[model samples]
Target: MAGLSSRSAVAIHALAMLANRREGSLTSAEIADSLESNPVMVRRVLGRLRDADLVWSTEGRGGGWSLARPPRNITLYDAYVAVEEGRIFSRHTRPPSGACEVGRNIGDLLDAEFQSAERALEERLDRTTVADLLQRILAADKEPADH
Candidate 1:
């Protein structure tokens, strides 16, 4: 189904990194290093975030990226919406066969179902802010490992 893209993951990761290091700006290379990804990919994701005003950047030496607002103000859904290009669920590439009874009815039914599912996912994401996620991440990192 070609479900979701990795953009959301990258965006969320970058946001959490920024939240963790709130006092200073991070270069794309630095963020990328933590992600084990390249600077180009990090910059691409950051560009969308910048467009949404979730983060900002500056030019020249010693300048890079920083969050535009406090972590508490930015929700996961905000990052999702900023970077994702379309609905989480996709529809058929072409019209289903109108002559067939199942095909005729399936398109509308599937669309309604997919939209509902997408909305539910969005609502769940909206409940957690960057601050909340950072807290959970920190707590999780402190957990003892089982042998």
Candidate 2:
């Protein structure tokens, strides 16, 4: 099975960062730094997020990215859907030979399984929000005293 793209990861990370700084905004460069990525890459993903209405941006001085809605209102599924479009699992490009019983049935069976899995994934993701993720992230991090 093919895995989801890193664009989803970037969008989630950026969303959490924005949630953590709900009072302000973060430039694309700031987000890219956290991901060890480039500003353009961050911008591209953020642009998709913007289209989804999960985030908004500004221009000129102090220009940056900010959440369009409250963090609690933005589920991980929202971010996932914004960046990752279409199916994560793909069926065969061409239909299998109908002469073989196994080949004839496998495609439909696998597609049903894939659709079920995708639904499960979406359900799980829809349960968490950016605020939820940030809380978990902070709780899981090492404190200065531990360092």
Candidate 3:
């Protein structure tokens, strides 16, 4: 039932912003302001990104966060794996009753299907980079020209 959580989305947004502003670092408060989110939440998401080596942080004066590598090198799949809680699709909370023939076979039968779907999703994610996302954002924000 659970899919990519808000943390994953926030991670992507934060990374995109960081990628766009490659010249300097940004505090979690500043990043959160850009995202219209809580600074604490931004810090938490950025912390996860930091742990994954997607972003790095500096403490104290002029301190903030910055992408560890170029945006083009960071795939969306990396962020997804960094913040998402579990698989794209999840099994039922309770194990199916093995006493029933259908229950006994359902997990095994659906596992391959779920795995295939996850692979498809990950493939799409792997194709999208933070640089690509920032480019799209920049393009969308551009003012239309008058003819």
Alpha-carbon RMSD to native, per candidate: 1.2, 2.1, 2.6
lDDT of 3 by residue, 1-147 (tens): 787678878999999989988597999999999889999999999999999999999999999999999999999999999888778787878999999999999987787899899999899999999999889989878957662
Q: What TM-score number comes out for model 3?
A: 0.88
Q: Which candidate is the best by TM-score?
A: 1
lDDT of 3 at 108: 72
Candidate 3: 10-residue stretch with minimal lDDT: 138-147
What does candidate 2's lDDT look like per residue over 1-147, in tens digits? Answer: 456999999999999999989477999999999999999999999999999999999999988999999999999999999998679999877888899998889998998999999999999999998889999999878456665
After the best TM-score superposition of candidate 3, give how far the Cα of residue 42 lies from its true spot, in angstroms.
Answer: 0.9
User: Which runs of model 3 end up more than 4 angstroms from their true locations?
Assistant: 98-101, 143-147
Question: What's the candidate order when arranged by decreasing lDDT?
Answer: 1, 2, 3
Total backbone clashes of model 1? 0
lDDT of 1 at 8: 93
Q: Which ten residues in a row have the lowest lDDT in candidate 2?
A: 138-147
Cα misplacement distance, residue 35 of candidate 1 (Å): 1.0
